[model samples]
Target: RYWPRFPRPKTVLTVKEVPTVDAAFVLQSVAGLAAKAALRGGNRDMVWYPIGHPAYLRWHEEMLRQTRANEQVLPDVWAVVEHFRRAGIVKGYVLFRKDAGDRRLHQRGAYDPSANVATVLAARLGAVMVSEDIEHEARARGLQRLADARGLTEEQCYEHWAAQCSDSVLALVDPRVPHCRAEAIALDAFVLATHGPLLERALARIRPDSPILGWGAGDEFQLTEPVSRWALWQSATNWCLNLPVLSTEQVGSTFPASSIRARQRSLWDLTWEDGVHYTSFLMTDGDNVQWLMGDFQFGAQRSWWNSPVRGKFPMGWGACLADLAQLCPYALRNLIRTASPRDDRVLMGGGYYYPDLFGKSRNSLEPLRLHARRIRGYLRLTGTSLLHMNAAKWDSPEAIRAYTVFAEEIPELQAILMVQYAPYTAGKGRVLWVRRRDGTELPVISARFAIWAHSPFPDDGPPAEIAAKLNAEPRLAEPATSDAENRSQPAEVPGFSWVTVHCWSWFKNAPDDAAAGAEETDQATAAASGAKRGLEPVAWCVRRLDPHVRVVTPTELALLMNLRLRPEQTLRRAVAELHLRLRTAQPARRSAARGFLDKAREALVKRNYRQAFLAGKNAARVLGVMP
Candidate 1:
């Protein structure tokens, strides 16, 4: 699935005055318009670059100067009227108006209706949709071209398009409905109802078994702007790939890709030693490409990526490589090009389509295999092996078994950096092994701690606090001990501990911090108005750690854990322990354990050790042997 030669834009059009209501709508429509024009021109013609974000603008300028020096540059570009006009693609405009009584509806989940309607119309009619507030601005900025070319008034042109779309516009979800009391539930229902059919229709147009893009559903709280921006990118991506966009929600039950592929190559060559607490830090939430293209690209995250201390330590960036390859190949290539060797590694973020919500049934392994294939394909393309995955239910053995498929299918996939958000979950700070057919083990290491706004661990707190917490964790402090009562067996070979530091929150400058030094403080303030936070906090935490702890890249951490752990013996012992527990377990627990045990034995017979371990582990959980 790697592009031998990525598509490059012949011209770059900069959209200024961004993040405003009017510009948001224009930004939403321009990419699709450019895409339609590209179809006529037989090449990727232009890149619709949005400005007004100082950090992003600076990054964009640097990237362009570095990558596409010879490409034509057009500054202060707007409306994209000429592209659409030349292509004769814009039939008319779909006018969306905010409710008079609820002017702020667009900011809330209610705006999803208009957003979905615009996406459907953009795909079907080559139509441009804009909010009523931007109608005048759009016209004066060249949207009037359609009306002038047709010798029709703007009102008449709008009416003509409106008549064609009478059945296309979706009605807003009524929050007053009895079952829609909660905002989250209402938003889910709204997306399912409004965007569901449109997405289904689009999917039907593509081959069922072909790989489709999983562009996530936009942010629900602020639906209007984000969805509008996504709609533009979605349209362009749809045209470029000739494939439909599936939300993580939509693909949870049944992912439809026939196979996923990436280039396979060695990323790094490193050796590991024992008697050290090996820690790897991973930056999280890169599964969402929209976030990558929006905030992560042009927002405060730019500063984080550009931090002077970035390459000084081993940091893993969780990135959606498949999406980047399709939407922003240049940025993806540049990111890999600029990465520090042996220190910075771009791990596959969320496994192609972010399988947190994927079904855990034995049958789901088919989709899981396809998903891993996609991740493996991209890993080969990017020359990396570690996969960082988020699980909705990481505590269950069935979930772990599903994940084992990645290690089973892709030998290149050395380890999985697993994270779960559920409260009181017991999987953290432990390493689960999947024994390969050749008797080798692949390690699945759970996050020891996380830096996230909503996480229980230190989020915005001082680095010293997190350092203290890490030093106190029993798993990191000493070798594992046998737990006979709980059936938690000791590591067959000990002396090494793996700690993964997961970060979901961006760094922000603290104004009161005298420790940042005057020069660093001034730089932060100037770069992003004090909104940006660099990797200094991570560096600080590592520096404050106990002397025995050694920071390593995720790749090295996996290698060390694999070398020390005895996968076959550990899994066999776990299964035997679960059988013993079943004797005294309650009837309900015994019944569940019996079923999972049967599956485990079956998988073992087939030499599917990964699945067997997961099934056995699940059985143990049922009998209260494993957490």
Candidate 2:
């Protein structure tokens, strides 16, 4: 069990106000470092809760109430520093500038060498990294204690720490060059390139068998911009190896307990007869721990779980259970405890690190296998069976077959939600199947439609346009005549459309305003609203959809598709269960189950999927296999 005994905090230090984005970023980095250091020092006596915006203070209070933990307010960032000092955890401070000048310029954005260097020095010496620019503001905000306990000025302290770390190996990267950042991140965990010593030190501190920390990017950074957050650098300094920071927010965090407990949700719960047009809406990017701890939950962009439209429709959230368990178990527990049964469904995202480039060796399957074993453990811990995955090479049959390693290792995994940045490149409506040693098949369901803010596809158009396209699509509106026809079509399973909506995409206006030339305004409004913009685009799309279309969860869509495509396998599982249950049943029930089983087998041969499913359900009921 990865269920850690969380620190029962006697004192919850709340940072009620932060001066700026830069200040908030520095404070959070310091807080994470302080928390880790305090825990390591055998003083699990406090929890650092920072609320950058005053509007989100209620969320902080609500979290405290749920945990039954009382709070002590730290009025400013300096006060937070003072508290850590008073606890005898922090010894000194290392200061750096947010802007590193021309030394770290990139075409996309500049990387801050100062920030990266500061992180290394802070960890090596027991100190907090603060932005040099914030000192004057901090002093103005009532900084009575100057230079920490070491009695050294910010520059003097940085120089002292730098001198000690002068011999440390550094992997200098040029962000302006294409694929350089990606290469650096891919090698950060294993090799000592680009702050490798810190990772090595961090790995040495943890158990040899412990799951590797896949500390992804920060809330402020993008794939092309590595300097904004320096999340990986911070993680490395804290003794946690950083995984590929690319698409960090695109992955997920924390699986809900209910998802695991209800893993046996009947495949027959959703049937082929449910509707003519079937669709499952999944929100992407739950893997970033900092994003979840920052804006996604409590900042201006807090429209996800707290949305007013939540529970109004079925939706799946992609999360990384392993990362949450290690970094912040309380947040994970809070997510599970507050999840809505009607709307909130958790699906594993990216599987520890991004599966596309997890291991050091690209040609070897051993790394993939090792990662799968760890993923299997996380799946069991989180009570999740479905996974949302992405691959660098997904077009070829060989590329698709690589995922069988996951299915082979994680026997309980029900299905995989395959998403790529460019869906058209992988072929439209692709569904790949692989058979295991025991003859069971695994499905890799490719996303047919996507709604992302920065998507480059024509299909990822406005909500109204996409909805209209769906309504006009004949394959989704009409049922397949034969299994072969269903298998051959670009729509994959007839009447079902697997839609992946990026978490960042949302609508600001009502459906009417969205259609009448407000599309541009929607994007602008979404950006402006920050955490306040809920899932209005989803509701907008739902309203515009044809009456024949039925919205369902990812689980429902996967099970329904499996039943439609593999009627024989579906019936076999039900029949086998019925036979086992019948051993203890009365003679009348056994006879009745036999009759239903026969009908199911006959209907399967005739390709009467609805009849076969109904017969299987009846057999399960007769044998007490289902209620």
Provide the TM-score for each candidate, comma-separated: 0.61, 0.70
Model 2: worst 10 consecutive residues (lDDT sum): 242-251
Q: Per-residue lDDT for 214-292 in model 2, tens only?
A: 2322221222112111211111212111111111121123223443333346764555564467777777666555455
Please give, for residues 223-329, the per-residue lDDT of candidate 1 as tens digits.
22222212111211211211111111111112212122222222112333334566677766556554554455445454456666778877767777666654444
Per-prediction CA RMSD (Å): 14.4, 8.3
lDDT of 2 at 160: 52
Which residue runs does candidate 1 get wrong by more than 4 Å?
1-20, 40-47, 52-79, 99-109, 134-274, 290-303, 350-356, 359-363, 423-426, 437-439, 452-462, 473-534, 567-627
lDDT of 2 at 214: 23
Clash tally, candidates in order: 7, 17
Error of 1 at 322 (Å): 2.8
